[model samples]
Target: MNGRSRARALGVLPGPLPTGPLNAITDVAGVLVGHTTIDDGADLHTGVTAIVPATVRALPAAVHTGNGYGKLVGSTQVDELGVLESPIVLTGTLSVFRAADAVLTYLMGLHPGELSFNPLVGETNDGFLSDIRRRPITERHVLDALEGAHGGLPAEGCVGAGTGTTALGYKAGIGTSSRRLDAGGGPVTVGALVQANFGGTLTVRGVPMPVEELVPGAGRVEPPGNSCVIVVATDAPLDARQLGRLARRAIFAMGRVGASYSHGSGDYAIAFSTADPAPALPDAVLSPVFAAVMDAVEEALLNSLFMATTTTGVEGHTSHAVPYDRL
Candidate 1:
């Protein structure tokens, strides 16, 4: 079960922009998010998350690599073809290959006789709190996540692929937020989902917080080679190039929340559009979409921390959630 309020509920991350009814990625019509969490007595902690876009079919998509230190299958195909042939899956770094294979199998089952399909899978290291050596995440977890995909708010923080993730020295996990923007053409919705495992100084708005002072043993125990995976979805019509630009803006949202962007961090973002309007929205109007990306990304990151509960795994190593009172 979720433990605390999201950042907006605490009045620390609200902006002028409004959120959709569920204030989640699902707010972008036809998008669904699901999770499969694995928690074995103190040693194995890892799982899979699946994001289904547009429900019934593939959609136009784009990807941006802020830091290329991790594995992300099918990114090249998505970039080359400007299409997303499969649902997006997120899991631990080492589980990416298996997860991709599982995703392909799952999709193939959905469309039997489909011989070839590019599986989009993203990952971040969760070894710090998980017995990653066990390779506990299996095809079953992938199938479960895909089968259980739902169109309401997703389970965030310490769930699914975020089960064992640690970020900004806190027990961070799955986080999501969405924004509603008016492009003069009509109202467009931009939503963000983040698997937070990267390290960084923690900040709120423009104020950098002394993380170690707030959470004991924060900076000392977090491992190196951390990573973060951001996924953005929108109802606005945008081609692959425009979507790539939107992906970059999602990274800017990381800076807003004080990401360290360290050498070993694998920071990547993927963006997709549910709409395919002719000519697309005018480039001049993309500013609202960009701003929406930044807003949703920042708030989602905060929610990853705010909603997370303390975790203890492998050898009694503990990753504590940020104390709610500090806010």
Candidate 2:
């Protein structure tokens, strides 16, 4: 929206499904997204991104882990209970606990008498381009992201949790996309927001990007201990088990964009439904939703890379943006 182009604008369509109006995760009704970018123009370049549903009540949700080399706070509870009672917060690796604590603080303030709370907080390493050791994310940053959550197009690339992240040898940050599926019962929307920080070959629609040719001297040096966290939201009445299936599809979509799923990469996807309590969709009708999730996830990952601008951070380290002309 800020004069920045997305993958679609650059002619990189991932699949056949039609995208929602905004072509973003916010296209899912009542889902709000906010970001707190902590860029000091010097060392700090990390911040937080919050995904808040319409209300702070339990919603059907599930988490799937592709490679578990990083932290994902409050995941087990969601898996066990088959619901999420908190707004999902994402930030840098070292700042995960602080973000989770802040989410707890915010949720507690909303419901004073609630005795227990499970705050979903996830993270990916941003040490390559940011002073991650400083752990600059704070309670205020997390709260700001949550409080400012709004429905519409969300800012992507070098913002929020993805500020200092890199993927496929290029700068990447927050990216989102959505798909409207026409199923047997009715139409349902599936949206995905990705914090892409993993390393791979940089493929777009089955074509390997010429990273070496485009950016000479940029060898295949994958970042150490990288990761990606994807959040999928849908308006379909999907139970936790169904949501888990969607989440797995999201993780699988990563490979479509050339994700290596390396040993040190922690690839995780959290899927939730915003529909009111109703009969879950039949398993037979879930194939379209799965296809939608895959398409959205792949496009979102590319948006994270395409929309990102070259960033210079900690100790003069720079993560180059994907060359649009070459693409």
Candidate 3:
């Protein structure tokens, strides 16, 4: 049976796959998610910052996977150091600059009586539902999301970066899932969290679940494209190339759900592990370690698809929930 068909027939949501303790991105331990949504004005279904912290500590090591096709600030430095020392930020497309600035300001306020800051911010296009031109993300909003960040089942649907998002011929938003892997000896956790703003016909395990069949009024603009921003976290030991390989496999899972990766889509993935850090001093060679990245990435993509909920955005545009009953 197709994925959706199977889900509908059994009356199940796909995210119930065998998981770790929390069945969420937080299962990885030390990871956290936070949101800030704005719907004050008509047709303005957008707002400010959502921070995804790499670790519970204020600063931790990080790395970026897919840096092209979208505006991601501070990725270059992350690549060089292989450590993310800032909170990950997300906002509407045009609000990236403002969001980045706000993150910087928020960082300065993080410590007591200290003021020095540099933050990482990523974005997706929400122009259709949000007033992208207004750049509504503010410093206070960024701080709130960061301050509120916690480790637990992250609030999904019309919240955070996914507040104005859609996916797979349905009203999609922020979704998360995790998997536990037996790498050689002990168990390692791998998790995925996504801001699903992409557009496409729904095809679950090969079933034809297009926009026309489900969300009728939710047609895309000319060129017919959508984008997805995925953040993968793991405790596995992997280098940059391995992380990139893991990110690439995420696209394959997207295809399994029937994503076309249309021209206008910003299909991107960023993956990092808090495992052993590479050597810093000269002449210190690091041994290659590759174990659970691929498996984790595959499961993570499915989680993003399965955990998402339906949504409504700008000008009365609404996307339906995945027809669990139809599956």
What are the Cα lDDT values of the candidates? 0.87, 0.91, 0.60
What is the Å distance of residue 22 in model 1 from its true position?
0.9
For residue 145, give model 1's deviation from the true position in Å: 0.1
Arranged by TM-score, best first = 2, 1, 3
lDDT of 1: 0.87
Name the 10 consecutive residues with the lowest summed lDDT in model 2: 216-225
Q: Identify the runs in model 3 with alpha carbons over 4 angstroms from their true place.
A: 1-17, 48-67, 110-118, 215-225, 278-312
lDDT by residue for model 3 (137-223), tens: 777777788778888777665567766666666655566666676553556677777776665556654566665555456564322
A best-first ranking of the candidates according to their lDDT comes to 2, 1, 3
- Regions more than 4 Å wrong, model 1: 216-219
> Against the correct fold, how does model 3 do in TM-score?
0.79
lDDT of 2 at 223: 70
TM-score of each: 0.97, 0.98, 0.79
| Cα TM-score of candidate 1 | 0.97
lDDT at 262 for candidate 1?
A: 88
